[model samples]
Target: MSSDLFDRIAAIGVIPVIAIENAAQAVSLADALLEGGLPLAEITFRTTAAAEVMATLRDKRPELLVGAGTILDSASLDAAKASGALFGLAPGYDAEIVAEAGRIGLPFAPGIMTPSELGAALKQGARLCKFFPAGTAGGPAALAGISTPFAHLGCRFIPTGGVTEANLPDWLAVKDVLAVGGTWIATTSDIANGRWAEIAAKTRAAVARVREARGG
Candidate 1:
């Protein structure tokens, strides 16, 4: 089931990292993403409305591939699963949390910044991971560099943090990158001001970049 979700994400080649301040925007946000040719969203646990937004989307826009982000512990993990998030992610790796995810069967991708962190995650059999704060961490060049040692390990990544459309292709160009976490697709201000069209436009532009990078 996790492999299917990951395959869908790779086919789209982008995951809109959304932080919703209000749950009421879920339907409109889903519509905007769909309008722009995107069907994936990572509802981050950065605000109080995260769970509600996920639940609303789960009930209203069932077609969208919704996942949970910033999942720091077992409690948040349980809440995310209950809210119908098909997958989960975090800013960093935690062994206990990863174990808990496996125990519950939630498709999870823990974050890894350093080789050691990546090693730790790989040690526990996690290949799909997040290269957090990608911009500060050297973007594609750095990811490509760190991933060299683990090339034979079947490591894949979802490069998040500071991932703008400008660098979206660069991130996608790396072989290890499955898809990018695009926070710019629909930012807080965009949703807050109900700029659905702008959100759709950004989503479309991101989709275009992914297609262009993949030579589609």
Candidate 2:
């Protein structure tokens, strides 16, 4: 399951970390992403409407790989699952949450920055992780430094936060990077102001860069 999600995400090479302010924007956002050659979204739990957004995308645009992010505990994971999220993501590692997700058969990815955290996730049998706040975490340089020890390992990374079209290629150039996460494609202001065309254009540019970087 992890490999399948990894392949799908890598194919597009970007995961839009979306924070939808209203459920009404969900379907249109999914359509915009599809039009831009990207169909993956992590509807963050930062807002009250996240789950609704996730469910709307799932039911309206079944082809989109919709999931829940900012998942901090088992309850949040359960809520995400109930909302039809195919997977769950968190910003930090928690053994209890991971255990619960495993017991429930949910494919999960915990956030990791330090080598210690990476080792811990590996011990927990997690092959993919989110390198959150990727820019503040040293961006591609930080990823390269930490990935050195686990170069032979099969672990892959999804660097989120601070990712942009200008620097996305840098992250994709890394050996173990599967995909990148960013809010630039569809910012809160963009959605609030109903700027779907701007979002679609940005998605196209991001996808183009990913294809160029992967030599696809």
Candidate 3:
């Protein structure tokens, strides 16, 4: 994969981590996000409908930058790849999954909670890591602290979990955070209520917040 892909992901600021209960809602959710000017979506493997949703989005809206999230094993990784995900993300690092992603030429961001895990990830050749359970893992402050030590290693982070609109600016302000991830903007309840417009509005608001934080 081109390094530019990482730049593209970072430019979006916040990646909408989505879990689809109904396969039919995939395209609509993707459309709402794209319309709001954010092109990236991390369709998580939290539900069985994830693969179907990935296939549907790939077939219907190929322009959206879609990836699989919450992948735990190689089987889930392969299923994501087969469904057309361009990348894969896990809540925690797994050597087998990371190796498979590399073999398939798919960019993967494995999770790291501590400096030790981060060090091990770098040893394994991962420059980009996910700070999962961001709130429980110390949020942006913890990330800020870790960044100082790991800065020389050229490590970057994508903060996920417990990320909210109110706290997004704090997370984005941290220089090491390349992007943030959250599911609040595209929850199943929003889709169930057919609130696409509302979701779009939330997406736009979130993007604006990121831009403001980035001084864009």
Candidate 4:
């Protein structure tokens, strides 16, 4: 992982997890997020339009930091890199996938909910990982406990599942957390209905939450 890119992510504090079905909305979505004062997007690879959407953003909205998500294998990781994604993430830890990411030079954050998974990530030299199903996995409390043993080893996290504007503070309060991924920021309906303004509003609120959480 590039230190500069990681720093940029840490600065943003809130990353929008985007999955747009229509490629036509790509640039407009970028515009909305930028308008909201947030310049980051994690385009999930689950949708067929993921790569195209990312490429469109890269060419048309170069200011937005685009990343790939839901990457389950090396093939998707390669596609994400080819699409010009700055980073990539998955919902679960896979040794092969982690190794492939290191080999391909794309900064990847594998998901973990237990110390065993965290150990796996560290063994592969990954300091930053994702805390998935966060709400059901005990949210901030779970992360705080699971990350304690590895905090001194330079471990960091980005808690995603169930993270939202409501509890943004609680999540960011953890010493090991670097950011929170807001799946609620840009939902499928929001994107499909072309609700750019609503998405932007939600994004702006999230940005505000991050600022408030950090006492900025």
List the global CA lDDT of all models: 0.92, 0.87, 0.88, 0.92
Better of 1 and 2 by TM-score: 1
Model 3 residue 62 lDDT? Answer: 93
* Error in Å for residue 207 of model 3: 1.0
| Model 2: pairs clashing at backbone N, Cα or C within 3 Å | none
lDDT of 1: 0.92
Candidates sorted by lDDT, descending order?
4, 1, 3, 2
lDDT of 3 at 25: 87
TM-scores of all predicted structures: 0.98, 0.96, 0.96, 0.98
Model 2: per-residue Cα lDDT over 7-107, one tens digit each: 88778788889888899999888888889888888899988899889888778899999879999977788889888898888888888888888888788
Clashes of 2: 0
- Provide C-alpha RMSD values for all models, in order: 0.9, 1.2, 1.2, 0.7
The candidate that achieves the highest TM-score relative to the unseen native structure: 4
- TM-score of candidate 4 relative to the true fold: 0.98
lDDT tens digits, residues 1-216, model 1? 377787888899999998999998899999999999999999999998999999999999999999999999888899899999999999899999888998988988999999999999999878789999889899899999999999999989999998988888889889879999978899999999999999999989989988998898
| Candidate 2 ranges beyond 4 A from true positions | none
User: Over 4 Å off in model 1, which ranges?
Assistant: none
Pairs that collide in candidate 4 are none
- What is the lDDT for 178 in model 2? 83
